[model samples]
Target: MAVTQVKVDATEARLAAIPAPDKGAAWIEAARDAARARLREMGLPGRRDEYWKFTRPDSLTAPEAPAAALFEMGEPQVFDGFDRVKLVFVDGVFDADSSDDPALAGVEIERLATAAQTDIHWARETYGILEARGQTPVPRPLAALNTACAGDGVLIRATARAEKPISLIYRHESKTSDAYLHHVIRVESGAELTLLENGPAAARFNKVMEVDIADGGRFNHVRAQGRDHERRAATHIFARLGAEAVFKSFTMTVNGQMTRNECVVEMAGDDAVAHVAGAAMGDGDFHDDDTVFVTHDAERCESRQVFKKVLRGGAVGVFQGKILVKAGAQKTDGYQISQSLLLDGDSQFLAKPELEIYADDVVCSHGSTTGAIDADTLYYLRSRGLPKAEATDLLVLSFLAEAVEEIEDDALRNEVTARLGAWLARRRG
Candidate 1:
């Protein structure tokens, strides 16, 4: 398929200036070459592009990284009590001194740079492969750019049921850092893995993650985009599921100046299940976007997308989600919902939900809604001897409960909820 031609403006030049990582492995180099070629043909998304109409791409595609002040954190770490293996990244570079041992019992972990030095590795075939596959129906030039130029990331393979989750923690100290990270995860047949990510990586961050779940494999991901109001990020996730495999991911974001999270999933085997959900809260010049695409190509596959955003004080939230059931994908079940809660008249929410089905035996549904807190509910809460601000907070939490509930892990859900509560408290104060 031919890539749609767009004008080569400053953004295109900026992308061209970025150097691609030169891995020693032949296959890795080949993948980067292919990605660079595709990116050149596609170019950066312009304001004219329909997909970028809601949010301007200028800030994300600029030649120089935006200046962002480092946030002085006062609260304890979100996953402080959790038992997990932690990998740390400082200013987008893997910090071996601060990270735990990469080697886990049932999982093999290698830094992308280290793995690339070997002539042959398991990641040779999977790295950037899924991202390349996802470009067909929709062109994700930013993701392709990350695949081509990302400086650091990880390659993880789960060979058996992992006893503990793997956590990625990012820390930012540079005021003008531009960080690009790419991760590859492969879950062997019957294996299970849980992955966790937290932090604001840098001033301007571009990230891509590709996951492959083998037959009967299970993968779970939970992430919290840190509360850095000056940060800007564009992240993408590409996943493929095999027969009876299960994939679930949930994200919680707060207070970034701009953030775009894109997820693409393909069910390539019968009876696979995939779910993606996010809960975001933005206030005062903040912008958040969630774009998701799920494709069903096998019989009896199921997929769900649930996203909710809370906007206040001139903040903006956008959601674009789609579910596609291909021909011969019989008995496919798909559902999608995107909702937003606006606290004031100045805040705005924009949503586009779609479903395309070629199979006659498929069941698909999509819905989008944006509104203020229910007057009746708020009145009831206020009448119960609660202050107006407290009552409003209650209603806001109620509105976000559905999406937060989508997190399958109880501990992670609680942590997310606590963080939301804290944010609400701060806003009210």
Candidate 2:
């Protein structure tokens, strides 16, 4: 494919601002070279792109990160009480002094920088491999750029069920930090792994996470991005699922200047299951976007995508989701829904939901909606002696319940609910 002149210039300008990192092992260097070549061919995403029409990519593709003021956190971080191996990153650099020992985690945990130094490693087979696959049918130039230039991240392989979750904590310390991170996770057959992520990574953050789940393997993930009002970010997740494998991921977002989150999944084995869900709340000048694509290539596969957003005070939200069932992918069951709750008329929500099927026996459905808070429900709550604001907050939580329910862990679910509830309450106060 020929790259557009505007995109070429945009891509070039971004690279010019970023310094090249140490090329690690032979395989790592080869992967980075391939990614750079891919970026040149694809260029950067423009508003003209079909998928980017509703949301501008200017800040995400800019040559330099916009300055962001630090947030004065008033509450303890989410998931603070959970027991897990915590890895900390400040301005995209790993912080060993604040992080827990990786040895304490059951899975094989190695920093990407460390693993890339070795001549051979388990990550060599999968790094940037899935992201490359995800590019076709849709060009994700930012992800390709990340693969080519990311300086550090983590590589994890789970050979057995991990007793506790692995948490990645990102802290934005600099006003102009531009950070790129790439992560690879492999779940061996019959093994299980859970990942938890939170925090505002940087003034401008770009991240890519690639996951490969073997037959009968299971991978669970939950993420929270928020509390930084002026930050801008773009993130992507590419996953491949094997026979009977299970993959579930959910995210909660709030209070960012602008953010775009994308997830791409391919189910290649029979009876594989994949679910992706998220909830985003934005106020004032905030904007959040969720883009997801899931493909069913094997028989009897099941996939679901559910996303909801709450917007107020002229905030904007966008959702783009698609489900594709290939030929011979009979009995494929896919469902998708994207909806938005507007707290006031000034807020806006844009959605595009799609389903493509080449199989005769597959069942697929998708729907999208945008609307203000329910008047009848609000009136009922207010009549019950609750203040108008309190009643409205209750309905907002109720509206977000489904997406929050996607989190399988009771504690995690409760924490998300409480955190969001607190945000709503504080805003009302």
Q: Write the per-residue lDDT of candidate 1 for residues 1-429, one digit (tens) a residue.
A: 344544456546777667656656788888888988887777777787788888888888888877899977665877767989999988888899999988788899988878877889998878889999998788888998898888689899999999999999888977646888899999999999999998889998999999999999999999999588899999999999999999999999988999999999999999999999999998898999999999999999999999999999999999999999999999999999999999999999999898888999988999999989898888898889989899988888888899999888899899889888998898788
lDDT for 414 (candidate 2): 96
lDDT of 2 by residue, 1-429 (tens): 688888888889988889887779899999999999999898888888888988899989889888888776655888889999999888887888989898644589888878889997989989999999999789898999999999899899999999999999998777747888899999999999999999888989999999999999999999999888888989999999999999999999988988999999999999999999998898998999999999999999999998989999999999999998899999999999998999999999999898989999988999898888889998999899999999998988998899999889999999999999998988888
- TM-score: which candidate is best? 2
Candidate 2: where is the Cα deviation over 4 Å? Answer: none
Top lDDT prediction, candidate number: 2
**Per-residue lDDT of 415 in model 1:** 89
- TM-score: model 2 vs. ground truth: 0.98
lDDT of 1 at 335: 94
| Poorest stretch of ten by lDDT in candidate 1 | 1-10
Question: Each prediction's Cα lDDT score?
Answer: 0.89, 0.91
